[model samples]
Target chain A: MERKTLDLWVGLFVVAGLAAVLVLAMKVGNLSTFNMSESYELKADFGNIGGLKARAPVKSAGVVVGRVTNISFDNASYRARVTMVVDKRYQFPKDTFAKILTAGLLGEQYIGLDPGGDEVNLKSGDNIAKTEPAMVLESLISKFMFDKAADGDAKK
Target chain B: MLERAITGIRGTGHRVVNGVWRLGYASRFFLAVLLHSSMSFRRFHLTIKEIYFSGVLSLIIILVSGLFVGMVLGLQGYETLQKYGSESALGTLVALSLVRELGPVLAALLFASRAGSAITAEIGLMKATEQISAMEMMAVDPIARVVAPRFWAGVISMPLLAAMFSATGVFGGYLIGVVLIGVDEGQFWSQMQAAVDFRQDVMNGVIKSCVFGVAITAIALFEGYDAPPTAEGVSHATTRTVVTSALAVLALDFILTAFMFRGL
Candidate 1:
């Protein structure tokens, strides 16, 4: 009886530990978000993606509503095409603005969706027409330096 | 003076060779335990018993420490990230830190100190009492009946312990980030869910803890088995088990992290 009780407790402990791991994997790690949910895909084109990865978050009002499913280059258009999987529950208008945004100065880049006033709700296969490309910090810094040098030359 | 210098160099070389020989012997012992452990299922109950002692018993320390560490991370992360108005990333910072680094490394260190030392002491006591010799005389292989079960127990329990630690740590971070600090609860969990990857972060942490488990248990059992059959020897071996296991866990963590996060 005592051995059986000990075994029972051990079994309970193992089960609890396993449960915690499952929760961690599912909730914190987002392991089940991919195949476990009903989502629809939308595509957008950007001139520059910067450091946006395939799994980057797609957020609206700072809430993640989807993920970047794929990123590809369109040679003819000279643009980076991004495929996003938005949750079925989140319906956005056709004219919603999709902007590539960074969380902080040195943080990871993600897609921020700004909903626009449009009578037509975007369908799954529809493409977002307007997309703001990722802001390149290096190019901005270089531009500032060049502008300063130009000003110096003008003064001289 | 020239002759003395030559003797000193030879002495150092001899010490190096002796250390290598001892390491080889310990490795052989570990192999023997591993081989014997696979040869039978009769000792499964014994392995479970050891797990109860090593894994279940160690849960309190692991959980409490994980919570405290996570809370501290929440506080510090909030302070740092708030500077740039990214205090919302507190959840991300805490979860990533615990899952990627502190979760496995600290749990293993604590496990080494708590259960690993206990294992060494228990086995050492058995040796001191000549029970191992008695078992051998009775035609029972002590390696199979004794060390292998304990070894397997440690290995199996480690990843579970680490996962539990990380889970609780995440909770602790939640408490601080959302409850006390008034950060949006939805944002805290959502940010964590978005940032942390199951394969990259969680699984790698599990792998690290599993490797640490094997290393720690092996060191514990080896020290116990090789200790001089005396009280002082047992105590000394127990201390060595803690120190050696800690250093091994840290070194292994560094190497594994480098490989696991190489491209990123």
Candidate 2:
């Protein structure tokens, strides 16, 4: 009986572990969104996504107000379409310009909205038409390093 | 004696080359055998049942070990990350490490030390008691009957075991981080949540665990099958299974690291 109970407990532990992981995976996989009802989306067209990926934050000024949802190509326009969700409380004006900005020196890039006080509140699925693509620092550093490395002379 | 020595050296060299040649064939054969054994739907169900028995039965030991391990890792990770003033990276480090490499490898090692030895001893005893011979006389392919079930069981159990390890390890790390390392519980969990994604590191852990399981089962099965028919033989095989499985797990880890991290 003791051994049988131990075995049952073991089964429970394994199942619990698996269930926990599956929940986490589902959460990350976006198969299940949590108790979040405050989701407002905005789209932008960029020449390139740059260092942006899905789940990168959508910030207004320096504060994170939302997150990038999905990126797809507008096949006809040859522009990259980015969809993002903004929080309910953070109101945005009509004339806001969204730009993809680098977070830190080496950190991942995110979309930043500069709200213009045009006295009009934006709604869900609005478009931030004015946008700037990301400028990758690594490319600049590579150009600086490799240009010097290949030049044989170490002089600046 | 000299000629025999020369022949032995030549034979060893030939064996190495032959082994290299046979590596692909061996894998193909193993796959074929696996498929052949499970051709019947009944065998497939039996396989799952056996795998559950062999694999899930070891969860308690794995969890207990994983918890302590998580605590130790948290302590170590906190101490090190604090030096660089990036103590917030502790959650990411622990999560990534647990998901990518530590979880699977550690569980495999633990399983090896526990189950590997028992398996080797049990199989050795079966051989010693002529039970295997009796089965053989009844025309059962012992490899397919016994070894294959265990091999499949180990293979199946590994990912589940790894999941247990990672979860407990994370919980353990959480305890150490909040109670001892002086990090806020929210911050630790949030950092872990932000850093760990399914694609980046977690999947890699499962894949590594699966491969490790296959190698461990193969080595254990091989060692067990080849054990001598004596009490001393059982002991030797048990020791060999533990040592060899441990070494093989570590070696496979390096191989995986090289392949996965080479470009990244």
Candidate 3:
């Protein structure tokens, strides 16, 4: 009986440990999809994703108040469409410039908003009119390398 | 003495080139091994049973290790981040570090050192005792029946064990962060949530664990199958398996990390 009790306690401990981890995972992973005030959806057309992934932060003036939810591509326009949700309380003006930027030197990309001074406010589903696409660092490096090759050939 | 030193320099360069050539040869073998991989239903069933025994049963050690690991990582990470006045980044750091790299690597290393050597020794002993030969004589494909199942079990078990390690380590860190370090639970949790990405680093950790699993099992099995025919040979094989697998794990980590981050 004592051994059985010990076994049961260990089992419980394992379960408890897993539960704590789950809660922590959810909390830290930001698993809450929608909560705290209402949300408004906006879209951005990007040429590349950079390191931008789903749930990457959407920031206004460096303060993140939203996240990129879903990414879809338009074959017709050859543009990557990003769906973003911003906290309802913080209103987006008509001319707010949505630029997707990466954090730090090697951090994941986030959607940063440059709040505009337009008197008109975006409705619940209204799109942000101005947006910037993601920049490819690798492409830039390759371009530089090719430029250097061109210079070498010109000298030759 | 100066002539000897000059010769020594030349010899060192020769050794370095030979080492590189040897590595190229081994990689070809490793690639060959990566081929010819398949899992049947029967193989899967046996693999599951073996995994439950070898992997699931070893949860106690993983947990004991994870708890302490989480605490140590948390304490150290917190102190450094606090110095930068980005104390809140501790949650993000601890969570990302645990889920991304350290937790899985450390747990897998520990498991490899413990369970990996045991598996090698047991298999090596079987080979030496003619048990493997007997099974082959009885029409069992030793590679398929014994090796494949064991390999599959390691592949399946290591990820689950690694995840368990990550989870337990994070929880352990939380205990240090909140109870001991006095970060508010809400702040700690929210900061962690806002900062960590399940896609970026968690995927990396799990994927790395899977690779480590394959390496661990392959090296162990290789060492076992090639064990010299003596009792002392068995001991040497076991030691070699552990040491080689551990070093391979670290080396592969560097290579995989470089390749992984290269495109990024």
The best candidate by TM-score is: 1
lDDT of 1 by residue, B63-86 (tens): 999899888888889989889888
- Per-residue lDDT tens digits of candidate 3, residues B1-264? 999999999999999998798557655544544443354234455565556555766788998888888899789988897776666666777888888778768877987877789888988999999988999999876766677667777876777778788888888888898889987777677667776655555657778888999889888877787687679888998998889888988898888788755533
lDDT of 2 by residue, B50-147 (tens): 55555667777888988998898899999997887767767777777887788889999988887677677777888999988988999987766766
Among all windows of ten consecutive residues in candidate 1 chain A, which has the lowest summed lDDT?
A30-39
Instruction: Quote the B-chain TM-score, candidate 1.
Output: 0.96
Badly placed stretches (over 4 Å) of model 1 are: A36-48, A53-55, A58-99, A104-107, A111-133, A138-156
The better-scoring model by lDDT among 1 and 3 is: 1
Ranking by DockQ: 1, 2, 3
lDDT of 3: 0.75
lDDT of 3 by residue, A24-84 (tens): 4465565553343577888878777766877778987777688787888899989888888
DockQ of each: 0.53, 0.17, 0.16
lDDT of 2 at A96: 90
| Top-lDDT structure, candidate number | 1
